[model samples]
Target: MSLADLEPNSLHVVLHVRSHPPKANDFHWGLYLHRDFEAGGTKYHLKGADKRWLADHGTTRGVFKSFLLIGLCQVARIPSGLMKDVDAMFRTYDHQLNEMPGLTCRTWVFRVLELLQKPHSGQVLLECNDLTSLEYELLSWGNANALAAADCQQPRPTHRSDLCGL
Candidate 1:
């Protein structure tokens, strides 16, 4: 499925967790294309050791960190169709950030969404194979955002802090 199919200018936010011997063990998160497609940008595409990731970027290592997608949510589906190329846009966005090593995936999600134009539904939902910790931050992000939108006085708790133990 191509990201275009889900609807252009939309983001599919996913939460992942893997406590195995493959590599690092921790809760992870990433973004994915809504539709199965021929091609999309590096960030929008799910790049990793998988064949799907290799076919596109020619590297087993991809921009996305979360592998074993445990949960997902259409964080915001902008009705405004994206123009130019989604990948190209992401390149510009990433370059602007001057991404450094150890860049948090949550930060990536927060930043990429900034490029999209306004006027979108704030509602979000997550579906995971198992019921787990991903739900906590999912609600945390949503709750913190709602508080900010309303200009709440209390400082929201740092997300990554007790959530991931990172």
Candidate 2:
């Protein structure tokens, strides 16, 4: 489906499990916004790994092509009619932050979440304040879903929104 098919103002955390060893258990995190969603009207994420990691893994940056989505959960909700602003903010935020040492998509996802929860953070809204718990819930959901490579990868869409079960 498309963003227009999702709930308005809803934000969900998207997780893609690494397929290779040595970091297979780890995941690349991203965000997905639903139709009329206040935060953003699209997916916000950093895919792929650093050059060295890429070289070692023989993979480039791209969803589905490089990794597979394993889990997702709704995390935040902003006010209606702010989709444009929030979408622009996230687009700029993604570029301004840049990828750095020790910073992965997971970092990007958490940073955005933190920003949305900051005091007086204009234009941004949240469904909850306890990110730690939200994170735990994601992990729990992943585990409960049996995060097996074969299980999570099969029977789902290759695109980001296909599995937007939210």
Candidate 3:
């Protein structure tokens, strides 16, 4: 989607998994914040690159993209300053190499999305086992989720409690 389409002051957070296989030191990524990532501005993310290959072309390699579409309550001015909380909450994720235990940029993005109460928690945005396989996995998951949502919306049969007074 075009950055211009985004309403003003709407913060967007995206997960960009690095381009590398598991067990590779270069297998890492980060949560990027920007209306238009390719346009570029102050982007936030964990910083690391063990190999030149990843370093050269790792950023923004993840094809799986999602949006937060921050509401006023999420980033609104409050008793605690908005920017203050924003910095504290987001900046820490950009910690230098190996600082956050086992969490990489990929995990960090997942956790951040979960913290914001986004769906698909604990799942990688761009797992690189096999591109074709991953596509099928995502499609199946999406279909199941849609079915579950549809089921929830279906009207339930009326119960005796509804006519108890009669």
Candidate 4:
């Protein structure tokens, strides 16, 4: 859907997952924030090849194309007013690869989720409560989809629903 379709003063937080490599169950994570029509949103994701996170202020379609998205772990509705705050939080969200344990796209996505789940001005940003459950859900989906595709020698999932069972 186009940005115009979203409700005023709100945006969508989509947690995306894709196969990492070498192993089917190994997965990477990313986020897509779709804001209202006026303030175009951005994508915060890690490029496995570069081993660093990249934020792209490009068209939603273009970002999705580059993501090679496999599944959506979760979709949340957040107030559009929090856009700048969230972006700033992302920019300053301490991500020291050397100090981190097994740093990957998943770690970055998890940190983002932790930030979003915090109460902002007494208002919770994301609808989710438990981050562990969210991770488990995504892991389950990845194991099923990734392993199936690898074993069956099937093409990558072509539809959004195919990946997440949404």
lDDT by residue (tens digit), candidate 2, 1-166: 3333445666667676654331433666777665552332456777556522221111112222324566446665656666555565565554444344666677667777776665434543654566676667666555444355435445323122222222
Between prediction 1 and prediction 3, the one with superior TM-score is 1
Off by over 4 Å in 4: 1-24, 37-40, 48-59, 94-98, 147-166
Predicted candidate 1 versus true structure: per-residue lDDT over 87-147, tens digit per residue: 3444544443333443455545544545433322342222222223544557555433443
Q: What's model 2's TM-score?
A: 0.64
How many angstroms is residue 15 displaced in model 3 relative to the true structure, after the best TM-score fit?
A: 4.2
lDDT of each: 0.38, 0.53, 0.31, 0.53
Per-residue C-alpha lDDT of model 3 across residues 54-115, encoded as one tens digit per residue: 21112232212222111110121112223334445555444343455565554554455444
- lDDT for model 4: 0.53
Q: List the candidate numbers ranked by lDDT, top first.
A: 4, 2, 1, 3
Reference-based TM-score, model 4: 0.64
**Per-residue lDDT value at 43 in model 3:** 37
The superposed Cα distance between candidate 2 and the true structure at residue 45, in angstroms, equals: 0.9
Best by lDDT: 4
lDDT for model 2, on a 0 to 1 scale? 0.53
The TM-scores of all predictions, comma-separated, are: 0.41, 0.64, 0.35, 0.64
The residue ranges of model 1 lying beyond 4 angstroms of the native Cα positions read 1-10, 20-26, 36-67, 78-80, 83-86, 96-102, 117-166
Lowest-scoring 10 consecutive residues by lDDT in candidate 1? 52-61
- Colliding pairs, model 3: 29-105
